[model samples]
Target: MINFPDDIFSEPADVDPDTLANLGPLTRLAGVWEGRKGVDLNPKADGPEQRDYLERIEMQPIDPQANGPQLFYGLHYHVHIVASDEDTTFHDQVGYWLWEPATGLIMQTLAIPRGQVALASGRASPDGSGLLVRADRGGPGYGICSTDFLEWAFRTDSYELDLRFNADGGWSYVSTTMLQVRGRDEPFRHVDKNTLTKVAEPRPNPSARIAAGKATLAQAHGFTTIGGGAGKGD
Candidate 1:
């Protein structure tokens, strides 16, 4: 038997407009980053193949999102990778890193061009320096999904990502993917790791920009008022 909220249609009241202020554990990820020492181990027909890659990632804040009473502040991100000698993209990914302030829940939604998507979930403290999130093949909430061709050729069993904020003000991640390839006797562990340094700062969210605009206008108006009053007094 399953139980759900009766007032599911009602959304949360007094939601915060500033996403960066409410991102909790995901706050450190909002920036443009680059990694040159990325390493990837993937399964091939013959055996495991190792490759080095250069990776760039950009994460920016979005407006507050709500699901009935549950609210989320998240960062929209894009990742692109290329080999050292190649100009073409080796891998590309887009995702959202979400943090729920009310529950201390961290979620990552990933979508690749290779017909696979996943939602991974975990828990973390607001000021924590590390996080680990996972999604299993048959989980009810955090689960993996793939196209039929991928399911038959290279079935994915699980996905996990471990993230850490370094003392040097950079971030690093290790991603492990469990795969059951066709005709393989054992599942293969596909792994990738990289430490990223910030290349650029992030832009403010839409709501924050609006707030700043309003503040600027108010300050201009006050200046004008004070100028006119001083002229009359003179």
Candidate 2:
């Protein structure tokens, strides 16, 4: 079972709105974005295949999450990709971009359509522009998981994503994944890169909207209550 705190409803010092603003650099990514010029390299039966694909990634801000003194502001994101020539899904990923305000820790949880998942983590400051996160195989902390078939045929050893924010209002990323294919003498480096432009904007959190609605109702009913912050339990 997923391990989480038990008393998650207890009031904390900082509430959801504060948490939203404190997510560091991730606040800039809280919107829909698309890129058509993503390039990917993967292994095939004969050899390596290089292809160009289209990518769409959407990251939305979430209410702050806390475990006692530890606080986090981040985005729940979905990444979708398709080959330029074909309409079928080339790749799909769902994950979270988490940031710890107190520790400058950035984490990424990735779940792909190919029956695999990983939790990658690293550290960065609020001032720096670039970020690199990584995960390794067979590690309990931030590690990788794969299906039995995939594990036997093509084992993935490590995954890394390097993100760079451009001066122009755009962002780019380079992904390098190391795989241990069966019958191969050495590990293969599969690389992919993409640059994204903002096609649209993000919406506010549902809880925020609901809270606004509740405030309206409370005002209509003349009830004044003060409880605003991230809860402390599951």
Candidate 3:
């Protein structure tokens, strides 16, 4: 269990404005990436279906966030996927990838348009080359939630994601989701894997850009101070 401090209302005193520099293992993932040879395997009415897909991902830094004494540096990420044989979208996801430097706590909070959302948690070294996080159906902190239709049809029992950064300046990930299909007696393992190449670099978070005089407050409208600083938009 995580230990809680007595002073829950007091925020951290010295929060750095540079989010990119403090993202720990998530630093390598801040960028736009594309993958052409992605693979997905899912359960079908008959059995299972496999498809090749194309994926594009954008990961941009967000201003530092805090919950009282808890501080986090993170990225706002969006993923779009299309099948190789079709122009229609196969999957779309948006999420935040957060890291707590003090505890090496890494978390991923994801939401899909098809009525599902999940929070996964894990631990990684500050300079690690790989990362992993998982979520189960019923948990207090890190867990999955779905709509009633999804629960009755294709209930998601668990989710896991594994990521590896390569020496060739690219990264890869494999995601596995356990599903309980309507009629299936056993759980099905739906999986997807892809290797992405960086296509663009990330922009600095709002506060960082402002601190460096690269942007004005008007451009950083939604940003708020994290620690011992002035009020929002001040």
**Candidate 2 C-alpha lDDT tens digits along 177-213:** 9999999998899999999999887755544544656
**Prediction RMSDs, each to the true structure:** 7.7, 7.5, 5.1
lDDT of 3 by residue, 158-222 (tens): 99999999999899999999999998899999999999999999988888978988667755655
Clashing pairs in 1: none
TM values, all candidates: 0.87, 0.83, 0.93
Model 1 segments beyond 4 Å from truth? 1-5, 125-127, 214-234
* Count of residue pairs whose backbone atoms collide, per candidate: 0, 7, 0
Which prediction has more favorable lDDT, 1 or 2? 1
- Residue 4 lDDT, candidate 1, scale 0-100: 50
Error of 3 at 228 (Å): 32
Selected candidate, larger TM-score, 1 vs 2: 1
Every candidate's lDDT: 0.87, 0.81, 0.92
Q: Output the number of the TM-score-best candidate.
A: 3
RMSD from true fold, candidate 1: 7.7
